[model samples]
Every structure is written in C-alpha cells, then in structure tokens.
Target: MKKLTAFIMLIALTGCSKLSMDNYQLLKTGMSYDEVTAIIGKPDSCEEALGTRSCVWGDEQKQIKAAFLAEKAMLFSHQGLK
Candidate 1:
C-alpha cells in the first residue's frame, strides 16, 4: 500500500510539471529558435510555410504556439487547460 501511494504521488507531481505562465514570460520577440527551445524545451511539433514557422508545446488541453519569422520568434500565444 505504501508503494502504491508513492507511485500515485509521483505521477501527480509529474503531471503538474507542465508549462506555466513563468515559462511563457521568458519568451521574447526576435529570439532564435535555439534560444526559445532552451527556455521551453523542444516543441512537441512544428509547422512551416513561406519562411514562417510555428512551434507548439504542451498537451492538447493546455498549449502554447510560437510563430517564427526568419528563424526568430515573432509572436506567441497560450491556451490554458480546461
């Protein structure tokens, strides 16, 4: 029973470790792709078009999308989990 309880606690803590507003605030316009990745870790996925790229982070319920132009972040937005 103690082992089971410990495992559950570990899972709960891990789930709560997703991106937060503090991490979002670290982003700034003109930051390079590598710089942004260093702050938020590698994006879960990415898309590109016409010299513009958008990277997505976090799970479906709560996520952030950052658009890059010329390999630098131009804008970003976030959605909270519901």
Candidate 2:
C-alpha cells in the first residue's frame, strides 16, 4: 500500500504552492540562489551581511530560510512546514 499512499500524497500536493517540504528537500548545499528560487519561487525578502546573502520565504510562523555565500547556498533551514 505504499504506492497507494504515495499516489494519494501526489494528488494532494499537485496544485499546492511551491513553498513546501518537498521543494525544501530538493534544496541542496552549493545550489545557486537562482536555482533555489526556481524551486521555491522568490523569497519574501533577503538580507546581505559579511558577504553572505540570507533569504527567507513565507513568514515567521512557517518559513523556509536559505543562506547563500557567493551566491551559492551554504545553509538552509525551515520552520513549521508539514
């Protein structure tokens, strides 16, 4: 029944927004900022410091955050995504 469960999940996720755990899982270290955006859509806002750019998608209650150094993803974290 794993296949059935997977199919039901796929159907549930079909038209949902890109800001999801699945897309977050797709993020990898060293991925470019543009590539990350291509998967998660544009970040709500971004900040730069110490030559690192930190971007966040969604809001405080539930968000995905990625830190890019030299425009490549160096770190990423998420909050309250199901």
Candidate 3:
C-alpha cells in the first residue's frame, strides 16, 4: 500500500494549507483598499462598483480571505464568473 500511504500524505499536506487561514484578518466596513491590503497583503480577487470596491484573498480551496474598499482608485470585484 505504498500508493495509499502516499495519498494520505498528500491529503494531510493539502489540509494543512486550508487550515492555515486562521491567521487572516477581516476587512472593516469603511477601511480603504490600500489599508486592507496593508493588513492582509494582496488579494487573489477583487470587485468594484461606481464608487466602491472589494478585494479578496485566498481561493476556493482556502476560505481564509480578506476584503478592502476604495473610492476613487481602481477597484477589484468578483462578478460575472460562473
């Protein structure tokens, strides 16, 4: 069962990455994108409206994500993707 053992080890290592999101921080209601990025680093995705924006970190595999807001600067948003 060397293959079985290898599969288990792979799963364990993958789970470690998912579990490490506990260290992330949430974006506040009025915080700007720059400030949020400063706290949580760059985001993997983002969304933007006329005067609002949101940034997201992490991916579907990892739930540890953050968001940010901006008024005039370019904003990132998650939309239109199926």
What is the model-wide C-alpha lDDT for candidate 1? 0.87
Lowest summed-lDDT stretch of 10 residues in model 3?
Answer: 73-82
**For model 2, what is the alpha-carbon lDDT of residue 46?**
95
Question: Model 2, 5-76: lDDT tens per residue?
Answer: 999999987768787788899999999998999999899999999999999999988899999999999999
Greater-TM-score candidate between 1 and 2: 2
Backbone clash pairs for candidate 1 read: none
User: What is the C-alpha local distance difference test score of each model?
Assistant: 0.87, 0.92, 0.50
lDDT of 3: 0.50
Candidate 3 wrong stretches, greater than 4 Å: 1-27, 64-82
Query: Which portions of model 2 show Cα errors greater than 4 Å?
Result: 1-15
Which residue runs of candidate 1 sit more than 4 Å off their true CA positions?
Answer: 1-18
Q: Rank the candidates by TM-score, best first.
A: 2, 1, 3
Q: Rank the candidates by lDDT, best first.
A: 2, 1, 3
Alpha-carbon shift of residue 28 in model 2 (angstroms)? 0.2
For model 1, residues 1-82, the per-residue Cα lDDT tens digits are 9999999999996676447788888889999999988877889999999999999998777888999999989999988833
Candidate 2 matches the true fold with a TM-score of 0.79
* TM-scores for the candidates: 0.74, 0.79, 0.43
- The CA-based lDDT of model 2 is what? 0.92
The residue pairs in collision within model 3 are: 46-76, 46-77, 47-76, 47-77
